[model samples]
Target chain A: MPHATGKITARELIDLQSHLMLESTLVGQFNHFARESTDPQFGQLCQKLAHSRTDCLQRLAQHTNITPIQ
Target chain B: MYQDQVTDKNLCLAVINQLKWSATCLTGKILECEDEQLRQDYMQLLNRTFAEQKEAFDLAHQRGWYQPMMADQQMIGQVQSDTQKLMMEQQQSMSPMHQMAQYQGIQAPQGLNNYQQSFTNPNLQNQSIYVGGGQPYYSR
Candidate 1:
């Protein structure tokens, strides 16, 4: 529980965590969009984005030592 | 590549400005907040924004776009100490029931119910939980 003094406070870590959580949510939304999308290119882009987000989620999990709720 | 840097700088600036505005809004809200917990929440948000501004300033300084005046080290130390004290005080304000709930959370591990129960019970204080190392059962 190292608190913030000058560089990188716990609050900032929490904020980073919050941003990652939002990203995960957005990725889920994109996945749903991709499923519904009729255009192959758009669907492919969404699937690629979802994979990228999964990688980001893994990195975020390593940083925070906490599993994402979803 | 050049365009990327410009875009990044613009994004960083936007984020910094947004944080600054949010901090101002929170500061005003904090002053008007009647509930103690709400006031504390606002203050925490303000502190977070201040931290974000500091980070953005550092990034700008690193890129040689701008330099910030160095803060007094002693003043920073005082602020850190005050924040720690406040956090400790907040933790102390929790009721005994809440404390017990927190304890239960710590003790509730998968597949170690019996082992956890043996160590966590009040009557086992006299008996050494560890076999030989004389270390406490709990790492914390």
Candidate 2:
């Protein structure tokens, strides 16, 4: 029911894009941390975090249907 | 040597710190966001990130990577006493202002009192000055 018209302002679109970018960047950082970790458990923890952030990124991207232009 | 010093604990700490900052950034953005839908969406993300950050912190604590310092009883008592002292000082400072306000409520202001007195003043009665006119204008 929220945003029933599905219309987004330029400012909203920019915010969405920035959120997506931050999420993506977090995912990359977690992935890198996973690889850099010496302990297997720590690596798995980073992987889980990365996956969670990815899910969040995907959810926001799908909700707003906006992605930052490369 | 620096690379060698990087351990699992250090890596976990790094991730935890990053998550903490990310949550803070999201909070600020959500506060500033004007759109209703965007605010709601970002609020959800912020909650999730905060939960995940807590999880990371717990894991680190369990593994002895992050040991939060526990406050001693003496320190706790000192803080409580200091806070009470500050409260007492604030109340004391406000007492004079409160008394002044109450006193003012019962008395007319000086300016109003002077203006009221001016109308009843006998010396100023029937006194006026000529303003480039042949006749003097009397004021009562």
Candidate 3:
């Protein structure tokens, strides 16, 4: 069944997935950078961002009520 | 176009799957790092990420969006048998040093079952990773 919460249409869910794809990739890149960086400060900041991606991912998942599938 | 074809459930499931893979990949990378301090930081982050995912899963479940499937007795047995076969094959084909080099600490997370819903529909499986629904643009 296609669910619509008020004005939130199915299109938005697709968009959310697209955004998440970018975000997850970006986080992965950031983590890679954090791992490779020699400077402690830069690495710490990148690591922090990689963590923050989690909260963003969570919000997106909540908004869409994503059906969990591995 | 694709939007019309996409049901709410399909859309939700796609997003959920992507997020699951993302988290797992991040965990794998964290496992690969040798620095203890960095690994600890990532471990903390993974903890937060898992917590948030749980909340989302609960909400999705409540709304009837997320449905987890239990592995049946036969399926479990099949998986065990398959594992044993693979182990034997690995033993026959590879040396211990090669195997150790290849194996990453990338086992599934505790909440792996959360994403293991029995999605048996083939039409659902063939859906592309991206949206826009594989429309024939030239037709227009």
Model 2, runs deviating above 4 Å: A1-14, A63-70, B1-4, B70-81, B101-140
Candidate that scores best on lDDT: 2
List fnat, each candidate: 0.00, 0.44, 0.00
lDDT of 2 by residue, B1-140 (tens): 67557788888888888888888878877877776777887888888888888888888988998998999999999999999999999999999998877665556566644555555656675553322222223345
Ordered list by lDDT, greatest first: 2, 1, 3
Chain A vs. native, model 1, TM-score: 0.72
The reply for model 3, stretches above 4 Å from the true place, is A1-70, B1-8, B71-140
C-alpha lDDT (0 to 100) for residue A55 of candidate 1: 62
Q: Candidates 1 and 2: which is better by lDDT?
A: 2
Q: State residue B55's C-alpha deviation in candidate 2, in Å.
A: 0.7
Give all TM-scores, in the order shown.
0.31, 0.68, 0.34
- List DockQ for all candidates: 0.02, 0.37, 0.02
How does the DockQ of candidate 2 come out?
A: 0.37
Provide the lowest-lDDT 10-residue window in model 2 chain B: B128-137
lDDT of 1 by residue, B13-92 (tens): 54456446656655665665544443454465467557756765566566665555777999899999999999988778
Rank by TM-score, highest first: 2, 3, 1
CAPRI-style class, candidate 3: incorrect
List lDDT for all candidates, in order. Answer: 0.55, 0.77, 0.53
Show the colliding residue pairs in model 3: A2-B8, A70-B115
